[model samples]
Every structure is written in C-alpha cells, then in structure tokens.
Target: MAVSKKRDKNVYKAPRNIGKPESENPKWLIPTALTMLIVGVVWIVIYYITQANYPLPIANWNIVVGFVFLGTGMVLLTRWK
Candidate 1:
C-alpha cells in the first residue's frame, strides 16, 4: 500500500492596505485633550504647593509649563471635527 503526503494548510496573506485612511474619525482627540488638561491642572497645583520653598524664577517656569499644556489641549479641541 502507498500513502500520499498532505499539503501544508498554514499560509500568511498580505494586507490590502498599508495604513489607515484619514477619512476615519480620530477617536483619540477627546481622550488626549482630557489627559492634557488633567496634567496641566496637576502641574499648577504642584507648583503652587512647592512655591513657598522655591525661587521666584523656578515657580514662574512651572506656571508657564502648566499653561502650555492647557493651551495645547485647547488648540487640539478646536481642531476636532
């Protein structure tokens, strides 16, 4: 008696598309904005709490950094469609 060999059934197929199209809604916008806002608020609070032990220049720098995050979040929200 003779037996036939079985062919391999496992094979990989290439994707038709390389990347996601721009037409899809970017769902990350809202969550990212919220994160930025929360981070900014936390920075401001930390700066205020430590201001008593730090120099004026350092405190000012922290305030500026916090505002930058808030501003960036606002800008991103505005651009959302």
Candidate 2:
C-alpha cells in the first residue's frame, strides 16, 4: 500500500483597519441622528399624553414608557459609532 502526503492548511487573517484614514469611516451619523430625533419627538408626545390622561397629581406609572423611549434614544445618540 502507498501512503499519501497531506497538504498544509492555509491560515486566514482578518484585514486591519488600524491605519485607515478618516475618509474611510462610515457616514452613518446623519441617519442615526435623524432616527434619534424622531424617537425623541415621539417620546415627548407619549409623555404628554400619558401625563394628561393618567392622573392630575402625577402618581401614575405609565410615564415610564415615555421615559424608556427617551432614554433609549439618548443612549443611541450618545453611543453612535
């Protein structure tokens, strides 16, 4: 019986972005900004509606929904990369 030699496997390497110029960065700021803006507007609207309907003395827990949206939008805006 004849023995066959095995070929060496090639290693793959990830491309480096370390030296990439500023121009190569993605231009997602505009779209992200717009999304955040829309979210904020909706949040405010929801907040106002909730405040007006739930109670007069502000003892309701429904305002949390509005705040959740607002906080999420703010976090997205701040953490946009």
Candidate 3:
C-alpha cells in the first residue's frame, strides 16, 4: 500500500485568543443559578412547613420571594450559553 501526500485545501490559521471571552460565561454562573434555584425552593418549603408565619412571620409574601429567586435563577440560566 502507498500513502497519499496531498494536503487538504483548507486555510489554516492558529487561534489568536488564549481563552474564551467574558461574554461567553463565568465558572460561577451555573453554580450561582443552581444555588438560587435550590435556595428559592428551600425558602418556600420552610415558609410552608412553618405555616407561613415562623421564618419571616410574614403572610403571603413568602410565595413572592420564592418566585423571585426562582425567576432570577431561570433568567441567569438562560444567559449561561
């Protein structure tokens, strides 16, 4: 058998950037998002577990806080890519 020596006709250029740009994402972004999501769930669970008057002693506002954290985490997750 003989080996071929022809080169592929593609322009070869070395990558100029050392690493990914900041616009891509940070190492902590996903973790932070996950934390927010988990914390949000825990916060809501505590509120419910305590009858919504043991943790913060506030009524009806517990749901709002949980939703806000969850929403923020979801938004952050969307920006991860």
Query: In order, what is each prediction's RMSD in angstroms?
Result: 9.9, 9.0, 5.7
Quote the lDDT for 17 in model 3.
75
lDDT of 1 by residue, 27-62 (tens): 998899888988888888877887634324564787
**Candidate 1 lDDT for residue 77:** 89
TM-score of 1: 0.59
Q: Which residue ranges in model 1 land beyond 4 Å of their true spot?
A: 1-24, 52-57
Q: Give the better candidate number (2 or 3) by TM-score.
A: 3
Query: 1-81, model 3: which lDDT tens digit per residue?
Result: 999899988978888875666576889999999999998899899998988785576688888889889999999999876
Best by TM-score: 3
Between candidates 2 and 3, the one scoring higher on lDDT is: 3
Give all TM-scores, in the order shown. 0.59, 0.35, 0.67
> RMSD of model 1, in Å?
9.9
After TM-score superposition, the amount by which residue 59's alpha carbon in candidate 2 deviates from its true location, in angstroms, is 8.1
lDDT of predicted model 3 = 0.87
- The whole-model lDDT of each prediction reads 0.78, 0.60, 0.87
Task: Report the Cα lDDT for residue 27, model 2.
Answer: 76
For model 2, how does the per-residue alpha-carbon lDDT over 1-81 read when each residue is reduced to its tens digit? 999988768867677976666463247754766675676567556557776564333444445555655566676566444
Error of 1 at 40 (Å): 0.7
